[model samples]
Target: MTASLEAKAGIRRHAPAASRHAYVTLVTNDDYARGATALTHSLRHSGTQADIIVLHTPALGEASREALAALGCRLVEADLLPLSDAFNARHARRALHGAAPFTKGRKPDFHTPLDNFVKLRLWQLVEYESCIFVDADAIVLKNIDRLFAYPEFSAAPNVYESLRDFQRLNSGVFVARPALATFAAMQERLDVADAFWPRTDQTFLQTFFPQWHGLPVTFNMLQYVWFTMPDLWDWKSIQVLHFQYEKPWETNHPKSEVLMPLIALWQAFHDGGPIPDIAALPGPSGPAAALSPSAGA
Candidate 1:
């Protein structure tokens, strides 16, 4: 889908030198458009003061593009990432479902946008001193603008813990400082096949920012946490719901019925309505009482 001339120009100038830190996400097509739509909606409802932006590639169909523009959030056009399977940032999320996700995924399409690499592209947005990248597959449960106070490379740990010792932080949510140098550094290392752990950008980020500050577990609540450790996450206490699996969009998803409320909630944002602004979000909730070592750190 082609962006309108006005939107195309607006995308180029959306980030002003005076702008402060902001929230960003990506949308590739109808599937992710739905998620991005809801995400922006929740952000507004939760009272986020920072600018909201949607970074998208040409693969986004015309309808999706116009729909997002109608949301009034800035739309920045991102080039398709050159790396293989790097176009879509959802690979790691898909891997969370099972070793083979093809069976459950949408029918293969001819055009696959480069989404994963866009994560690195965030560094190219030099105008903002900092940014919070919330995966579109999530919804904000409360105002999380206070997270802007944290330093760069801050993120929550992946909710899934394997029998193996290795546990990568979920890129579903993160705070980063966008810089050209960091973007260049990532590109230089992309050629190394082993650069990305488990063949996804989540690991590349972990390797690049090994000393990243940690956000509270409540910042990005994954579906698996509710499935595997319910006590650790209280919906009333959480900030965002990272739709780890069984997304609200898929009619047959196991969590579809229970998570159905999220649809109307997302729609309210998509359709337009009043929501709390940044100043009114619930009191900053602390991490769970028994946060994992990586989580509470």
Candidate 2:
């Protein structure tokens, strides 16, 4: 059977099963493939009993697929949502970036705004009773199996800058219940005439589930918190470390110097090197620390 059909059947066959939760992430290209690898490694390091699933688009390369499979991640090939041509054109990288430029930090060249929509496919994964979707650029620092018990639409508030930012939900890491009904409802509302989502899936999801449950920021800790709100930087408390704007894999990106320590942590996971005790890492310091509170104020 085809993937879509299999997904549908899996939902029917497995939805009623108890404790069938999975950790899901998306991989749109080779760069994110590398990120997903580190993420999966970290999940294993965290000793999670849940299954690891990598939902990848066709853009991901074979070598990257092999790496994820070798690490025991179940690969699910996901297709982009069939939105209108106008919607796709509007959200195309060039047009979207021109209209709403990212000024806070640099986004890597490999970033594609449109590809992010593929994350909606998570709702189609009805086979798993619950799934926690973590962005490929993030690494699990702690076993978050307890998140499966959180309600369907639980997510961390997008609180990198200030307390007010809590109004917005960050899609980087979230708990979801897989059901065909939810997926169908999303499709019906996703692509309307002149419809546009500035932040792609992140925007649509926040709108679709306006009353989304708030997961603690520790569950999806944005890297900016290191510098923007150093007081929130508690290694022991962070369950997931998200590299939001600039990726840790990039060489000499704009924020590279400030993010080096976190990048080093990611490298150790990616390179299969000796994993360091996160609590032992030095707390935030330097000019970056000086720039916060005001920026977030």
Candidate 1: list runs displaced more than 4 Å.
1-18, 84-114, 161-167, 193-196, 257-297
**After superposition on all CA atoms, what RMSD does each candidate show versus the true structure?**
7.7, 3.5
Please provide, for model 2 over 92-196, each residue's C-alpha lDDT reduced to its tens digit, 9 standing for 90 to 100.
999998888877777889999999988888888777889999999999998899999999799999988889998899999999999889988988999988888
lDDT of 2: 0.85
What is the TM-score of each predicted model, taking all chains together?
0.74, 0.91
lDDT per residue for candidate 1 within 1-297, as digits (tens), equals 124652432234333443587898977667888888888888877777787878877677889878877776677777655555442333445542344343322322321323565667777777787899998888887888877778888898776433231245778899988887887788777645433344356767888888877777788876555434645656567788787645566665544433344444455565567543423332213322233333311
Count: clashes, candidate 1: 5
Maximum-lDDT candidate = 2
Worst 10 residues of 2 by lDDT: 9-18
User: For residue 265, what is the lDDT in candidate 2?
Assistant: 95
lDDT of each: 0.65, 0.85
